[model samples]
Target: MTPGLRLRTAREGRGLTLERVARATRVNTRVLEAIEQDDVRAIPPRPYGRGIVRAYAAEVGLDSDAAVAEFFAQFAPVPEPVRPAPPAAPRPVRFRPAIDRRWATVMIVVIIAVAAATVVIAVGRRVLERRSEPPAVATTGVSAPTPAATVGTAAPSATPAPPPSSGVIVVLEATRPAWVAASVDGRRALYRTLKAGEREQLKGTDAVRVRVGDAGAVRWQVNGRPPQAMGRSGEVRTAIVTPSTAGSTN
Candidate 1:
């Protein structure tokens, strides 16, 4: 039986009026009426509407699970037709130009000569400068006094520390365009229209579940975690990410 019908029948069987059920369940009378009448338009999308129906069913002593199942079944999506695959074509071989033998040898010789000249000039300049420097002497104009050589100690090395472990920020875009309820690690995150690039933050261990219509659902975990098939409303595409730990300069 449909959820609306089941709800209606359960209420009537219990000898309860719509207003009585509404008041007890804290659901609006209009919404309750809609559920009984199978007017799904009156309720919001699942799991928002699902919560309302569940709440109403619980109050009326109806089987909430059965009602929800029926509701989803009624709205369950139709499967798309599959298309035949196209025939694969053989890949064309690519050819690259080979170097001219004579020019290649000349180029190598020229490069070697240039490099050797540069090295010799650099070393010659350094040796000339060292030979030209005068030896250290006492400040007073007299016989040069030899100063005792002091042993120099090396300074401590300063190494940069590694960044702290700040968890990921995932931006999940819904493959199917629809209103969706997204959850991270089983927490009620948000119920909003799943636009492209919609983002959410989750710890490294958290799993992601997106319910896309009554037809499509997908599950993927953050940081190489296993994938799970979630209840579908529509198609879902997941992207893993690590958020920046640095504070914004702005």
Candidate 2:
């Protein structure tokens, strides 16, 4: 039997409907139906189609690895044998719009500005001390020095230090393939498709916001607290999520 038939038979043996399986897996109902009917050609490109099959198999308590392997055996493209062609340099892999890259750049500029200001303050203090002293204060005689204006630095304080940092932390887990756009502290952070089982963590001193292609497919956690739902199934929605916003937006 084909891999599709095996999946169909297994699902039927447990007397479950395609809709029930789709709901549990967060996969589309039509995709689940097509898989069971052995009409997965309707799923378009083979790679994403295979991902759907793998996720579905796992959700149904099937041997996911074995099912995926069998699906690959039936559909995987055969690689072309190497020939005497010109050598090509390896391409760099890129994750587009990576949030941390921009975040690091902003932090570097702030640090440089702080260092420059500190240097200017230190140099000015030294110049002022040289100009203020009297020329007669450097007398060679052994007589007890007249009290030329004296300067004293204050002693360091013995106060307790405060905590290092504090901020809102946002976590998002994608149960299915969905388009996601996120911003942390009003700056664009992530804008791309989140594949199944993907997770993102964001920290912001102000706030975090997100929009999802399918709101129900994502689960969220804020500020190290308990997990909460995002929105209704298959709903395209945008929400202003922060430490305070916990419930789904339906």
Candidate 3:
């Protein structure tokens, strides 16, 4: 059976009303009704519609994963046949000349000699000009000394330092009817219900504590570490927590 049909049957079997299922799932009553009747038009787009259906099924004590899988099975499109591979690409061909390689070597040596001569001539002209010209005399009584050569004494250039790394932004929302509280670096964050597509940002340098119902508590470190347990609640809850570094920004 389809996921919507299965969900509806399970809900009815439990003697639960659409309104009761909606309240438990935190989804709209109309959406619950639409899923029960298999009215795809009433729900939002794909993934979102499937998520709502899953949430609703879970709330009504139905097999959520099975319902979701069935939902996709009923709605997902079939794959088309794979096309044949194209023909192999043509190989590149290289060509070599019959001329003597020594001639090419001689030409390269001549070019280098000409370039060195040009540089030597330029330096000689600058040196001769300085030697031929007389030094200027100062108008003041004191003679002005020639400045010392600046070779190998270049001034150090200033470079700007790089900015500190920014912390990650984690948005967490509940998928079921449950209260959620988050703590980052020992700071209490606001807790709220998980809407169908709600998001919240949590920032921290150390580990972050996320408490769901009395049965669910998961701690996440921002540095890609495994989740640790702080405590737990008795409902479906999710938390987005990021670890912070010493140089991380607030």
TM-score of each: 0.34, 0.35, 0.33
What lDDT is reached at residue 195 by model 2?
A: 82
| Residue pairs clashing, model 1 | 212-233, 212-234, 213-233, 213-234, 216-232, 216-233, 216-234, 217-232
Q: How accurate locally is residue 52 in candidate 2, as Cα lDDT from 0 to 100?
A: 75
User: 2 or 3: which has the higher lDDT?
Assistant: 2
Which parts of model 3 are misplaced by more than 4 Å? 78-90, 93-250
Candidate 3 scores a C-alpha RMSD against the true structure in Å of 22.1
Mind giving the per-residue lDDT tens digits that candidate 3 earns over 176-209? 3434566665567755544433445576664455
Indicate the TM-score of model 3. Answer: 0.33
Where does candidate 1 stray beyond 4 Å?
78-250
- Local distance difference test, candidate 1: 0.55
Estimate, for each residue in 1-250, the C-alpha lDDT of model 2 and write its tens digit.
9888888888888888888888787667766776776774545344555667888888767998898788667755758954333323333446466855765566677666666766776687657643442222222535544444546855454466584345667788998777678888668998777888999988886567777767787887876667766887666567665433432222
Best by lDDT: 2
Comparing 1 with 2 on lDDT, the higher-scoring candidate is: 2
Give the alpha carbon lDDT tens digit for every residue of 30-85 in model 1: 66787788887766666677887888888778788876777767765646854333
Worst 10 residues of 3 by lDDT: 241-250
Question: What local lDDT score does residue 51 receive in model 1, on the 0 to 100 scale?
Answer: 80
Worst 10 residues of 2 by lDDT: 130-139
